[model samples]
Target: MDLIGALPRLAARRPPVLLVTMPGATRERLAVEAELTGRDWPSAPGPAAAAGLVVAGRAGGAQWLGDLWNGMPRPRAYVAVAHAGDAPHALDLLGRLLSSGREGDAPRAVSAGAPRGAPGQGGGDGPDHHPGAPGSGARETPGDEDGRSGRGGQEGRNGRGQARGQGRGQGQGRKQGRALGLGQGRGQEQGQEQEQGERGQEQERGQEQERGQERGQGQERGQGQGHGGHRGGVAGLPMAGRADDRDGLRLDRLHLPLGPALADWPAGLVLDVALQGDVLQSAEAHPWEAAPAGRYPFWGEPWLRAAGGEAVTRGAAERRRCASHLDSVGRFLAVSGWPRPAARARRLRDRLLQGAAAGELAPEVLRLTRGVARSRTLRWLTRGLGELPAGRARELGVTGPALAADGDVHARLRVWLGEIERSVHGMDDPRALTGVDGPRGRLDGPRPPSRLLLAALLPLLPGAEFACARLILASFDPDPDEFVGAGHG
Candidate 1:
């Protein structure tokens, strides 16, 4: 065979080959290896010594060469074969490759000038019966196992090699003639196991491919059914509608959080709403569809859409209002008799500032929130609240709320939240705020009862500490429509 054309023939004693071919080429190379490469993805030995990279088309294994040398002590050579007869070019293309290895034949140790067993070839198969002989895998005869026997013998214990046929008189001669099948059978088992392992992996890969194809087919069928429904000219879903982002209307089969299932309605109707800090953040009144709006969904239709956040649509302003189970905070503020939720926040902020200056807040509170409220003064209020100057509140363990864990217990915050909520919602009047002064001159002015805007914040905070500390979130009217859009539609 032409050595260059027959690379595998040349590589029978070379390093393992790794065919880094793409999909189309992968199948091709696998078949080629069976007939040509004489290697496979698994049987390749180390990560380093894979034989040849049989790639597809062109530019196959070029990019992968550098990455191969990254952390390796001695990088293995690459043979990028996009087509046949590319082996010689691959060797030439690689500038540096490990040279053929030295130290193959073991040096014979001889006395001074005794005739050495030449350079190559073992002592003519005499001691070859030993396990480490040239033909190590080959078996020996039973007679060879006996110390008195030579490499070829018909007596004593049988090794693996067969002996010459002899007369039937001697038992050793007869035994040698009749070979035991022990060593020969073991060799066959090893080959069978390797074949079985390869077959197992191939079966696993086939199963994976089958599953993938099944999933793809299922997805296609579902898409086809949806397309057919739209083309049938439905009333709720428009045939021309794209995805929600591209089309004003979004049409897909989805559930309404609080309404009947879409499967009940031939034209799937859905509704969605989101709120933050007791105020509507955004509202979308359109369908997961857009063609021509249906004869305006009935006002009492439980799942009617609203302009939660959609752009102005034709006659959108005429749609009936949608009620959101949102803005619990705003509802509570309304319930609490706090006038004008939005306006009261400004007033509350001023009072907190006043309390800071008057030394009304506990000393630790000032330290935590105001960085010690630095000032050059020796006033009485400051002296009393900052230091223990025999004050009534100071005398009691309730030294205004504690700042540190030791000073103030978190459990107290829970109690305080309840008390504040009760006060805000009219469960208890603001007058019940024992040590606090009424609205006006004092910090935290006891405002004349009016609606307060706390993050449009509802007074019914969920967590105990939040109720106590008033951990209310704020609403930001990010878009101008938030105010003008009233989301009435």
Candidate 2:
């Protein structure tokens, strides 16, 4: 925008006018040259070279004022005079801009009065303005300024020559722009059509799916109707008479007898046998459908339990065998000696003596007792005999061989006996015995055998349970037996 040198030339040379075309604020466009020239230089182009210049003011067309300078006789000398508020800069550049300005009279019609406010009638533009007046080949109207109507409007209306020049210079560019715009419009329309086609296809697929679903439902209903029709026909048929009802399992005769040897039937066939007092007589084979219940063991001995029957022999079953209960008990008793009964007997004897001396037991019991402890897992049953009765606390303490060796009852009582020993020796508080309802009144109790199963049989033996628990530990460590219990007795 700075034009310190161009201002003096504009005024000295008196270029008729200047033309400018650019998009900017109005103030900047109008004051651009004047803003740049701080003061006028002494020498510049005179009125002989510089004259009024013209520029397009409107936008949105390919024929902008920039088009005039696009093809120039020189590049660095391209500044035209400034317009509006900027007109002073062009007038100021009159002296220095002389060598660069194009000197020519303005066209006769359009330049008629630019030197003054009277359009084409002003004298200040001098002789150059009248030289190009008749360049318009058309006739002039008398009342029109510059022999035209509106200045820019007249150019637009009657622009055969000017438009031809502007259009020829920008011909290829304008055509390309129009072609691009057309292509974009076509692309937009095609996109919309493609979207609509996809929607239509989706709607058609949805309708087809609905039809298929309807067809399937109709087929199912038809099948149900056909089944009902068949069932109705079956209902019309008559049923059997009452005589056949009572005979639930009718057997077919397997073989006809001709007073000869008996022929064996096939193994799998079920039969109803009629015998004469444990003798084989006649057999009528029956189908599985008509077979009587609980006779399945006749099929084979392998399935005796499943058939709800037991094997029986007609003979050789009632014979004698050497057997007695005493012998079995004697054998079991034979293994009981040494540390088992002798050691057991002395301990019980000692307890009796202590109980009598302490007045906890009847004195009569110490004189006539034997000790035999039975093994049991329940703390109650195995110790019952040695325990005092519920209310009869004075019963003989060690009367029978009650806590016999290695029986289920003996194992359970060992716990209570230990408690009693602890109480006797000050190992346990005597007052604690009242809390458990123990030895004096709590002994001699009876409970069912399932207590043994729950405590001993159902739960694993301690050693066995330890080994079973180790199975889980093995998943974590390679050497589990070192920490987990080994399966030892």
> Can you tell me which runs of candidate 2 are displaced by over 4 Å?
1-18, 28-66, 72-77, 80-87, 99-162, 167-489
lDDT of 1 at 228: 51
> Mind giving the per-residue lDDT tens digits that candidate 2 earns over 216-332?
454444334423322110111111111111235333211111100000111112222222222223333322111112221111111222222444321111000000111111112
**Candidate 2 C-alpha RMSD relative to the actual structure:** 55.8
Each prediction's whole-model lDDT (CA): 0.24, 0.24
Count of clashing pairs, candidate 2: 59
lDDT of 2: 0.24
lDDT of 2 at 115: 50
RMSD of each: 37.6, 55.8
Worst 10-residue lDDT window for candidate 1 reads 258-267
TM-score result, candidate 1: 0.16
